[model samples]
Target: MKVADNLAQIQENIRQSCSNVGRSETDINIIGVTKYVTINRAKEALGAGVKNLGENRMEGFLKKYDEIGNDATWHFIGSLQSRKVKEIIANVDYIHSLDRKSLAKEINKRADRPISCFVQVNVSGEESKHGLSKEEVPSFIEKMANYPNVKVVGLMTMAPFLDDEAILRGIFRELRQLRDQIQAENWDYAPCDYLSMGMSNDYQIAVEEGATHIRIGSELVGPYDE
Candidate 1:
């Protein structure tokens, strides 16, 4: 299928997902992850009406940022290295893998303006996942209060690839619950209003469970022609 058609299908699903739960489709942002596609293909997603684009690597983001222009919002959705924060700090609009204070300090020092960030939590306690333990999130957010340049906009988590729908749903639910718990704190800096859960396989479930942002890659942009 064409990238445009793929995008249309995803959008329709997003609308239906929102309708099923009485949430407005506009409440959710579709981040067409372009980490695996060429810049030309990334532009195809933009032409198809994807306003948000996500890249997992600094080099890929920089290359695409230069080639794709500034018409779209850029999201850095990978585990960002603190040393490379300066490389992407000024370019990307959102960083979805903030799980530590050192990274936050770097972003605070490098970002010219406040940058939206999602505190990544390892909800499932998977050793391979690069996120702070769920137990550490509250203190983590509290410490973030000192980083004026980092806005605690949401929470993000990666569910292990599995076929069981119930498990995936639970993982998303955990992230949403964490977001709600944090948002309830009413911290001045941690306005934790969004849940950046879901990816290509489970975004619809994520939306139904109160996800404000979904990062979709192959489902929206597909692989590069190479």
Candidate 2:
């Protein structure tokens, strides 16, 4: 299908969901995830009016980044390693998967420019994933305060996918809580102002639960890989 058609559909869905829950569609940001799609497809999405694009892998995004030129702001939304940080640094506008103190420190050290970043909170406690536990957020953020180069923009989480809204809500809720807590503690939270959650299937619900930035993957690009 056409990108405009898909965008319209998703916007309509957002409007419908917001109307039901007494929220405004304008309040939420739906990032067009480009990890599964090609740069050509991403160009189509940009033409279709998408200003933000999200990618997961470093090298893949680097390839597409070189070809796409510069226009849409890119967000790095997958698990990141300290080793792979340099390649993705200048290429990304925001790093969404900064999961540990060491990783954050590493990002801080080599970062030439101030990078917008989110602390990945492992709200689901799944071993298969990488993120700081909700309990560890305070200390993590404290450690991050020492990093002048990388600015904390907010928190990100990927709830374990299943047929359970409660599970999703529980995780997203934790992210929201952490975001609020951090903000309350320091208004200078700089780059940290977003709560990135949700995907194609569960985005509406995520918005209702207070998601400022929703990482929509299949919803925008249609299905996903990894």
Candidate 3:
């Protein structure tokens, strides 16, 4: 199927998921993950009314940003290297993997303005994931008070690719709970309002659990054509 068709279907799914929980579909933001697709395919997503685009690597993001210009809101959704912070700091609107104090410091120094950041948490306790532990999230958000240039807009996590809905939902639920706990603190720089959990396979569960941003890849853009 074409990108437009895929996007339409995904949007419907999002709407239905929101309705299931008595939530407005507008509460969710579908970020089309265009990391592996070509510029033309990414444009197809834009033509389909998807204004948010995400890339996992710096090079690909820069290339797409050049080709797509300001037509979309860009999200850096991968493990960002501290050394590369200066290169992308001024470009993207959201950084979805702020996992360390060093990276936060670098972002503060490089960002032209306060960058909306999601403090990544490895809620599933996956050794392979690159984020702080659940126990570390509160302290980490507290530390963000010093990094004025980095605005903590939310929290992000990647659930293990599992078929069991119970397990996947647990991980997402944990992230949402953690987000709520942090938001209660009412930290000035960190609103902790958004939950950047879920992807192509598990966005519905994420939305039901209060996810404000869902990063969709293959289910929305499909595989790269060129």
Q: Quick one: best TM-score, which candidate?
A: 3
User: lDDT ranking from best to worst?
Assistant: 3, 1, 2
Task: Supply every candidate's count of residue pairs whose N, Cα or C atoms clash at under 3 angstroms.
Answer: 0, 2, 0
Best by lDDT: 3
lDDT of 2 at 178: 80
lDDT, candidates in the order shown = 0.91, 0.82, 0.93
Candidate 1 per-residue C-alpha lDDT over 146-206 given as tens digits, one digit per residue, 9 for 90 to 100 = 9999999999998888778899889899888878889889998889998999999989988
For lDDT, candidate 1 versus 3, the one ahead is: 3
Worst 10 residues of 3 by lDDT: 217-226
The C-alpha RMSD in Å for every predicted model, in order, reads 1.1, 2.2, 0.9
Q: Residue 93 lDDT in model 3?
A: 97
* Model 1, residue 108: C-alpha shift (Å): 0.5
lDDT (C-alpha) at residue 19 in model 1: 92
Instruction: Give the poorly placed runs of model 1, Cα more than 4 Å off.
Output: none
